[model samples]
Target chain A: MARKILRGIPVSAGISIGKAYFVNRQKERRIPRETIPHHLVAIETQRLRNAVEEVRQGFMDARARVPEELKEHGAIIDSHLMICQDPKLVESAAKNIEERAITAEWALERSINAIGKAFSAIDDPYIRERMQDVRVVGDKIMQALIGTPKPVDLPAGRRVLMAHDLTPADAIELELSKIMSFATAEGGKTSHTGILARSLQIPAIVGVEDLEDSIRDGDLVIIDALKGLIFIDPSEDELAHYGDRKYQFEDYQKAIVKQCHLPAETVDGYRLEVCANIELAEELVQVKDNGGEGVGLYRTEYAFFNKSNMPDEEKLYEEYATLAEQLAPQKVILRTLDVGADKLLDEQAMLDEANPALGLRGIRFCLRYQNVFRMQLRAMLRASVHGNVAIMFPMISGLKELRQARFVLNSVKSELDAEGVAYNPDIPVGIMIELPSAVMIADTLAREVDFFSIGTNDLIQYSLGIDRTNKHVSYLYQPLHPAIVRSIKFVIDAAHKEGIEASVCGEVASDPYCVPILMGMRVDGISIAPQAIPGIKRVIRQIDMEECIELLGDVLTHATVSRINTKVRKRIFKRFPEELSFFASLIEQDDITEP
Target chain B: MEPSGENNSLEVVVCVENELGLHARPAGKVAQLAQSFQADIALCVADQRADAKSILDILSLAAPQGTEICIKASGCDASEALEQIGQLFHDKFEGDT
Candidate 1:
């Protein structure tokens, strides 16, 4: 048994075992508060000034060393530099030292406390958060004054980095090459630490509870970021187990990357189109690098959000045109704007519905605002001339809404025709079969569109009558439930009956255990995030369609989710033991919670 | 905001045009440029005032994009300070969106 086990949200995927080295442990230090002699007041003031100068020089050096790719982090360093030298901070501390004749450490602490008090009074949460930056700068000065500055410089070797909360300045100043992996006590899924770790291709876990308290500076720790687990001072058996696991993970990574560009075909000669679902046009490079056949679902909401005003039609056209041109000849299915619910526009916020998920969103929101919808349809039509561009509409409930969307598209096409604008008149039109109503009547909807994309994430949510984000009922989110399996199969059959192709583009498609079942259903294609492509394609290549079909047949007989999960888990895990260890599966999550 | 009749005192109303508003990067730029001149500069968002030379003071204002800010300065180079500082806002701090 290990001495301790800590769990966190894993941002990057890998396995690493190394000595832990904490750059900034959040353990509160006991300050020696002493009243200085009148004679030594000038000396204490000088000491304070010297520390400030040293820290400022450190910031400048870090700024100079900012890598070309990480230039964004440089601006954050400049903010720290200004905060370090600000009179509101430094001058106040100096004033405290002179007037009270106290030690520099106590004076600085008092100043930070005063600033914190002032900051807490401010109502703006963004500004209130700036107090953390003030504390980070203050901590640096405190370390300098205490004469044990910069434990950041590691001796000589790679180690797992631990921190209470890593600031941008600390990340910039640290020698990144020597760090093997990282575990931070603070930060959520989208934290800076996660972004840095991912860019460096190192394993990392954030929001790790008791990370600083459980592990010391030199303790041997294993970071199983694949499952977001940390084992400290593990037993010999555990270490050996992890040692083999790490070696296998690395070997698997190399193997999959080398074979990624090859077709996602089963051993028995079953072929599946594997595409990438991306939001930004910039991710095309990633798609190509990961061996994606094409862009399966291009979420068109990003350009519409995060700005003060709506994007003009011209800007939208250029963005789509560039994307289509870059991925020329390969299909790019652009999903029309699906906003509201979790992501709301300025105008939508005024409505303020109690249950947004069941309210105006997706096609409903687009149909209500015809101008915005028409503008997007015009851009999509205009961009279709550049490459194999197809337009998809999200959250369609029935035939009427689909027709309304197509009506708007036809009107835009006629307008472009009148203006003598060039576009592809035969641009493929598709709809995401996510809503339960759409799945039931998919046969009718399929006859109207060119293709079908199964959005399993939303389908499972709406079908199960559970919001997966809600903790209380999230346990009910069974991706491999008999109902979900039947729903997916029914939609695929419906699409096939109408001579249309059906693809799965959701978390379900990315799972190693779930992909086999999807393949068994004869899904025409599967669209997933770029990073998941390699491993998923590897799984597809290793398996046979005959066995997957057999597993599906066995799953069909099971009445409960637990039974279906058990049957699938045993069969899939036995077949692909190596792949199962690395990839986090939707089916595997059920084992821990279910009886 | 109007400039006073005194040659030394000048004021300009500039809108926060950056997408993320007057966050760290823009606030740092404002404070750094403010330090170069000998002007007594203050930024006012409605009734609150912040010393223009201090990044902390500038950040504490928490002005989002489209918020109107009055840049007040009084010194020998007050007009020049207002002009340069106002230009930074118009340029969106000359960095990322």
Candidate 2:
């Protein structure tokens, strides 16, 4: 039979073959709502109480079942339990049952909706977020009342998830090993689900309309996210063809994994340190297996953001210590809590700034809460004793902010010293050159810091004044923008002149096209997704530094993003055609949509 | 009949300091702390009131950062309850600014 190929935006890149698991949220088993007879209202109210208690117990059990590394998120479950235990919430739901002679499910929904209405009526964004909590609690209670299990029943083996849409939390809660990839019927390239998929390096195709209608559970399919095609019941020839491609891809990944053990060097013999940016310590194996020299950017905010209550000193230390001990002599650069944009904060704190990406975030936020900043600094200092550790601050725009952060670090160091806590006295501190102000003042700022990690993603965003998250403007959020390249080169040159190391970590680090441009610009190191380590390293190994520099010089003079974008792709396609698919991931969406 | 003991009321206006303004973590902290008090605690933002003891309720108040919320506590431990809550806001719910 001829292969039937469906297309969508390839939000994440890879290829996978599996039986489909079609999940439509609107079609799920929900507790049916029927009004109870007035006499049976008492029983309905009692049922509501029992269900709440039972679901709260379920949350506790689920918390205990979460892996130890993710135990920090237990506090979130605890808060969920608190919602269940809230008398005001329970009494309101019970009141619905008693007064309206309604079923428990209907009463609970009514109660939660009433709360949601009140929340929405308020102008506060923080209070509006509470609507989701009520919805979550309502979901749990509904599950209890209906005697249903947790959503998304995973098969014993690998299966592709075909959902109408999936939230970031739901995606995180999924069994990553059992799911091959995601084929969602809605969402665009910058969806929260898309971001999560890319971070997890899962192959996903989003915005495939009528996907549920076209395919059912147990249907065999091949998801070619690289080409944004799903081969439905592929022909034997097509299956064999995709089968070969799959092995080649797996073989390529294995080669990349092996490259981790090899020293990352350019053909001209310049050694470049390829580091892995990780969220959890458990990813250390990938860092090691992928030949990462050390942890370049440890997002420490996961510990703080995942919990209801901020983790205490000891809890933060345990994670830091584990990371230090595991990586040992190789340095771990922990970016202290970049938590303003996209990072969950309380509603009250979220006000004042209409635009989050440009608002009071990153270093601006940390400096405001000096105590919390000091605690993190103290923990890093305490952990440095176990291994080589450094501190890097994100979204720093000025020398004053850098000095203020340094002051907090100094205060913490003095506290540790007075307490006689043995910590490395010479832990290096660096600043991420993510803002245009940081780039313009790189020389002055470079004199004060140990290194600069040009966070190209944010640098691109802030430089172009494009909201990378907004789909309408995302097309303009290009890494190949002349201003972006020059800004990065400027930062690297400033860092080099100051006798400090410079690196690039962000979407640019993983992009095959950006790697050449960055290496050519003479960045000392690159930290990227663990899986992308080998592909980037392999590309670096193939090129001489002089050739890359020459190529960069050619593109830097180009006046437009498209001119630079066209020239770079032409250079890669002309020189290294075998790796065409590597650049395709970043460029694919624009091609199919544009002329 | 509510079990809030010893009728007394205490009220204070406090600004939310934490960034992300009264989002989940701070709201959860507010709910957690409110549960420990014997008084009935209610938080009002923009004249919209939410039961302080409920995460869902406090979250519903949706006061942005810098929002001056009025925390009202009634019954036996009202003063103590208000003081602790006011302190949390002063400390920015112990969340980074």
| Candidate number with greatest lDDT | 1
Which number leads on TM-score? 2
DockQ of 1: 0.44
Q: lDDT score, residue A356, model 2?
A: 74
lDDT of 2: 0.80
CAPRI tier of model 1: acceptable
Clashing pairs in 1: none
DockQ values per model? 0.44, 0.37
What's the residue-level lDDT of B58 in candidate 1?
Answer: 89
Candidate 2: tens digits of C-alpha lDDT, residues A1-595: 4345677767776889888885555636434445567989888888999999888888889988988899778877877888888876799999889888888877887788787777778776645665676788888788788676566567688889888777665676678778889888877655556656766777898877668668756778988877777878878887787788878777767766675577878888988999988887877887777778898999887787556788888999999999999998898999987877666556316575777777768988788777778888888899999999999999999999999999888888888889889998888999999999999999999999999998887888788887765545667768887788889899899999999999998778877877888888888999887767777788888888898888898997889877787888788767667665533445435675310
**What would the per-residue lDDT of candidate 1 be over residues A1-595, giving only the tens digit for each residue?**
8898888767577999998877654533434355688889889989999999999999999999999999989978888999999988998999999999888987998899898998898777877898999998999998889876553556589989887776433565678789888998876543445544654568888778888668776789999888778999988988998899889889988888888999999999999999998877767887888899999999888788735589999999999999899988889999999885556776678788888888889999999999999999999999999999999999999999999999999999999999999999999999999999999999999999999999987899899998754434655778988889999999999999999999999778988889999988899999987877998999999999998888888888889988888888888889888778776566664332200
Candidate 1, superposed: residue stretches over 4 Å from native: A1-4, A9-12, A16-223, A230-247, A306-308, A471-473, A590-595, B1-97
